[model samples]
Target: MPLVSVRQNWIVLLVFVALVLGIGMVVGLVAAPGTYVRELKMPDLVLPDAVSGILGLVLSVAFAIAGWRTWVIDSNSTEMRLWLATLILSWWFSPAFFIMRMPALALCIVAALFVLMVWFEFRTWRRDRPSFWLMSPSVVYIAYVAAMTAAIVAMN
Candidate 1:
């Protein structure tokens, strides 16, 4: 059996979006006003928070598209699970970095995760050449993370 049907994939994606929005609303309204201000002190050269957020959202959508394509082509592949897990973990790294105020640690974690993602993508591509393009969004995400890390380092 497939990991998730096409319809189920859409449902999961919708649910993920809803969860993110709900969390955002809670953080914006319920959390202390200065919560984020205290946690994230980014340099001016880095993109503004809103712009970086939008970029992350766009990149996430791209990853979703890639995941959907992978599901359509071969939902049973183990790589699909790895792709999904990597997506979820990628979502965590930003909060983990900014909220924890540990750029060096976060950079190390991100680097490790990037290596793992690349390895998974390579395995998937080797097993199924047709799905090679699915890796592009993952690469973009890694690049984004790297840029963020560099900006954080430059700030100090």
Candidate 2:
């Protein structure tokens, strides 16, 4: 198998970020007409709940795939366990944030999950020296989650 380098992993991370942002913009545009946008004074921006669920679903899938790929590449039992936990926790975050309408609590939960993911990746990197690409996805995920949380909190 071809060895994946840190640079390659960074490229992958950038691609994933682009994909997530692109999807979000597309979804926002498509759902905009039906969405009720609330203007926030602090950030001077509009918040819409219309595509929140869809964005959540997209992020969940991306995280799952990233976790699965990392697990597969590392072949570590601990990594596998962490990936499963992240996947399950992430899957629940969307509904809790959007459907239950508890953005703050949901953000906390997801933040914890992101921390866990980073710890897992760090451990795997130390033990197995897997490509940085394996860990980059977690970084991207965390950034995305943080941005969403900021938007949610600002809107509220």
Candidate 3:
């Protein structure tokens, strides 16, 4: 099979990233004031807004690093592209999970994402050791997902 041209692939990736971030920024702005509304009736919790925001930032950086590595260092292999697509689609659901406070559904989605992470790890481990670096964000994200799930379960 003929290889994909790097020029075309890079442009596509860049456009994808730009669109994701642009939508994210708009959502963030609209949702900024309502961070506490959903939990109004519940007891005051230790999970601070700043802390959640920081976590979001960390996730974003990790994702950007993984994307950069994928585009700059990895070849345009089918496996790599599949992993990228799954990661982005899964990530698109993440903020909504938090915004909606739908912890049960969030847990389910993150669990699926965790499975995807494991699959990605299995696929790339022997072939590319640095794939773990790309997959590290999943670790942090899974941790957060678990915590949020626990919190939601406890509140119910």
Q: Work out the TM-score per prediction.
A: 0.62, 0.54, 0.62
lDDT of 2 by residue, 40-145 (tens): 2224333344564565556544554454446445545777677666655655555555455566777787787878778777766755444335556556757676
What are the candidates' C-alpha RMSDs?
A: 4.9, 7.7, 5.2
lDDT of 1: 0.62
Q: What TM-score should be assigned to candidate 2?
A: 0.54
lDDT of each: 0.62, 0.57, 0.59
Report the error of model 3 at residue 20, Å: 5.2
Return the clash pairs for model 3, or none: none
Can you write out model 1's per-residue Cα lDDT over 27-77, one digit (the tens) per residue? 434432245445555655566668866865665565565566566666676
Error of 1 at 126 (Å): 5.0
Sort by TM-score, best first.
Answer: 1, 3, 2
Candidate maximizing lDDT: 1
Would you give me the overall lDDT of model 2?
Answer: 0.57
Is candidate 1 or 3 superior in TM-score? 1
